[model samples]
Target: MSEQLAIHGGKRSVPESFVKPWPYVTTADQQAVMEVFKSDGIIEQQRIQSEGLAKEWAEYMGVKYCIPVNSGTAALHMSLTGVGIEPGDEVIVPAFTFWASAAAVLHHNAIPVFLDIDPETYCIDSDLIEAKISERTKAIMPVHIHGMPADMDAVLEIAKKHNLKVIEDVAQAHGARYKERLCGSMGDAAGYSTQASKTLSSGCQGGLFTTNDEIVYERASLLQYFGEIIVPGQEREDQKYNAYGLGWMYRGDMFSQAFIRSQLKRLDKNNSLRIRNCNFLTEHLSQIRGLKTPYVPNECEPVYYNYVVGFKPEEIDLNVSPRTLRDKVQKAMKAEGVSMGLWQRLPVPKQEVFQNRIGYGKGCPWKCHDSIIEYKKDDYPKTVEFIDSHSYIFDVNPPNDLELMGMYVEAFQKVMGNLDRLLK
Candidate 1:
């Protein structure tokens, strides 16, 4: 038992701090933030950088327009609102994503129909999406969950057949591409987050709304910043303060915009490094009997937002359930100085917020005019099986120092080398 337990005085494979540094800030980032303060013109003086960054992001993603907002949730709301999702509307979304994806649907007094994800890709199962579509299904919000692009080709076809709009929740994927085309560019409109942990971080909280459709683009932009719906540079001064409808102060601040632009300079490089690290770890981890690496598709180039590893219960001699085995393995790994994390514990529909019908209780959104979804346990059995027991995330980043990745491989190997602790 001592041989299998790092906590019980076995040798630790990694250093005390194995976590890759986050918000990888530099002098340029500090200077950029200072410049925002020095100018005292948050949006007015730095408008060029703000506008330039928006254009730059759109161009990089191969989209026609980009709207910079305060958060990914804001962009999502704008996407749904832009595409005319209203009260009682239903948006089909993967159950594996952040709360924001479904929260946006509820934001508009609508319902989010949760679908199971593909165990291999950890993304929305395109095949299963069609089964869940109903008359209330207004759109398909396929999240590129964990940076791997969902089956967009299949998703798009499903959307088209159902006459539904497509809104890609691209919060985790920045440079990720599906079939050589970027993730954000494929949907009718997409939302991106520059939250601190995201691949293309804005150095602070930020969001972007992108689309090729001119009308959707226009409406999205207006919805973010006070609904000042007017063509840029053509706004008459007489209507400077004219707000046509309900709009929130959702635009990203100038400081965030400036830093995001600076970070954009090395976005691709960072993603490349992350990809290398992930691939290297995958190669090494696959050798261990119980560990499973991420499944990368031939047509998809994922960004590796969260490097997830799956646990195959049957392959190993550990008698415990997959969940218990993963917990013990992760504990042993952490003792060996590796930072491991749990992926989402519950599928979206099974979350207490959804099952309890928090928003639907008043019979408002969840109990909308059209859809009343009763979320149940094990509704998405496949999704639950994959995540609840089979998977755990390694909190890694696209580190500039490649050698640190070796330590991760060693730590994982050491933990897996001793499975006796997990055996009942």
Candidate 2:
């Protein structure tokens, strides 16, 4: 085993910079899309391709229904709305997550009662949920953060006991599995992001919602299409503009649908490469002092959306703080052409938008306050510690050509060699 040298305080070379300009979209995939575009069948009728792709995705997710939408946020909003999350209702969410997770809650006029995350999975702490549950607690939205599965057993148990709904935010985890069940199929309903940076991007923006419940599926489908109710036996003259329920225009575009369908065929192949690269990095980096790789629970088959690493303050020999160490290493790696940067900042409670309500702020949800009696930063100690100590390393999508993997491996090793000096 080759050991990495500590280069705590040194400038990086231009070539050593992390190198993922854009996600890997295959030429063959593009060609297939181009062929679709050229065909009269595609140009003539867009709905056929969209419907076909939705069916294909449904099969892929092992769910009864899959509705493709414009974006992941839209999918989340629809899922929440479809399941009856109304104004003033409180949705328990993990504070340590992307803004979209909470944003979806707020969009529905419901309040987001932020909860703490499990430090290992960086997901909602299911154990802490009972303490926050109240009469007003309508749902629990658990995000599969950075591809690691949350403890679904615990989360489900709490939900069952409390009679609360479970909505899985699977934007960061496509093809991820929890206890042999696919992620999108785990909860009452789930949302998937096919954004450009996600594991299963469509070369553009799109999202998917999956559910087995017929009522939930039907309501969600109508919600995505502006709530237009097609009556069982009535033929409407102006069908395009009619609506029967409250909804929005969150339909998926034809081009994005076609592109994603092509990409879906190779998702497993791409995920396998990510797994291999992540395992390699973990095996090598674990030997470095002061560094802690992500923890994978026994039940999870994670898809490695982003490879997160933590630098414990107590473990480091350097005088610099964890934040300073992160900055220095990121700067050096950038100089070396590597794109290393922190992914998430402080928790949601600390953010100005949530805490201060600068532009359009609402006070914390009533249910949260009533349940905990007083929501305080001190309450979620582990969540705060994880945010402060962690920095994210993006796991590049598997290159269209597997040969590029060697270059990536070499670059990572070189970056590791300069770590000690970068820290200084």
Candidate 3:
């Protein structure tokens, strides 16, 4: 273990961190691509690879149908459009998430009603969702943020009672299970991202929309194309005039489909490795004071995409800001020959795109019970408090050898040893 640590923390390697160099791309993936390349079929056409990949993904996700798109954002847009979310409609989304979650709703001319998240799980607070729903509420897009499954049971119940459509954003969670149920299987429809950073990445980008409803599935399929409902005897000329509804060119390419299909096979094994690393980190970090690891539900099995650590500034008696702490830790790690820093930059709501009146019309309709919601500095007491003290560790593709895991553990311990000094 010590020798492995030395190898990982080489002479040129900085102190605070070292990202696992070798990425996991199985041989099966390469073979899959070669098969596609050699096949005498339309490489860029949507009918060939996209449809086939969608079918296979549907089976993998245990859904009746899956619609493959160019990107996850496109999938979300299709799902919202399929559910008939139009202008003036409001969709409830968590504030502490990727901007795509809210932006997708805005794209369809629907408003996004931002909701607070549970401090522990870091998912939208299910209890607060009911109160946020109004007459204009059309859908609830709950993102399985950072691979941790949201309170789907509660979210689904509320959706049912309110007669609202539920669109599960399974972008961060591909094989995550809540009480043995897959993340994509819980809602009316779900969106999965095959972006480079995700578990089932396609190297470039791709997206999948899964659903049991045949009508919705068909609508989403048509939306991915130019909304032309493919019919018997309707050739290219006739199909142009027989447009079904508004649509976008969000079709996935043959190459991305081939790569994603190959990567999907090894997702479970990779996720298992991530879980093992997370367990080790959690066990070690739990013993330390003033730092809290993420809380995973007993019934919920997360894929462990990004391991977040919360620092209790009050407990530490440190006068330094969260940004300061983040910088110092990262610098220290770099000095120790580590190769990483904090995961995320800032919270979603804090971004200039959300604050400024750029493409997104007047302003967002997000509000909190305690304070008036302003995009700039309007006090998001909970959000601000959390972001100020929180730092994250990203565990991407873990080292193939388990010995490297021990090196990470030792490096983490070394960083924590002088935590007080680093914060100061």
Work out the TM-score per prediction: 0.94, 0.87, 0.87
Error of 2 at 157 (Å): 1.0
User: What C-alpha lDDT, on a 0 to 100 scale, does residue 105 get in candidate 3?
Assistant: 78
All candidates' lDDT scores? 0.81, 0.74, 0.73
Candidate number with greatest lDDT? 1
Q: What ranking emerges by TM-score with the best candidate at the front?
A: 1, 2, 3
Q: Which ten residues in a row have the lowest lDDT in candidate 2?
A: 1-10
Overlapping backbone residue pairs in candidate 1 total 0
Model 3 reaches what TM-score against the true structure? 0.87
Tens-digit lDDT string for candidate 3 (154-218): 99999999999999999989999999999989888888889888888888888888888877777
- Cα TM-score of candidate 1: 0.94
Query: Distance (Å) between predicted and true CA of 60, model 1?
Result: 0.8
Candidate 3 residue spans exceeding 4 A from truth: 1-23, 44-46, 231-241, 316-323, 337-339, 343-346, 360-379, 399-401, 420-424
Alpha carbon lDDT of residue 316, candidate 2?
53
Candidate 2, 42-160: lDDT as tens digits? 64435656677779989998888788888998888877876778877889999888888888877776777888888888999888899888788889999998988878989888889
Candidate 1: list runs displaced more than 4 Å.
1-5, 40-43, 230-238, 391-393, 422-424
**How would you order the candidates by lDDT, starting with the best?**
1, 2, 3
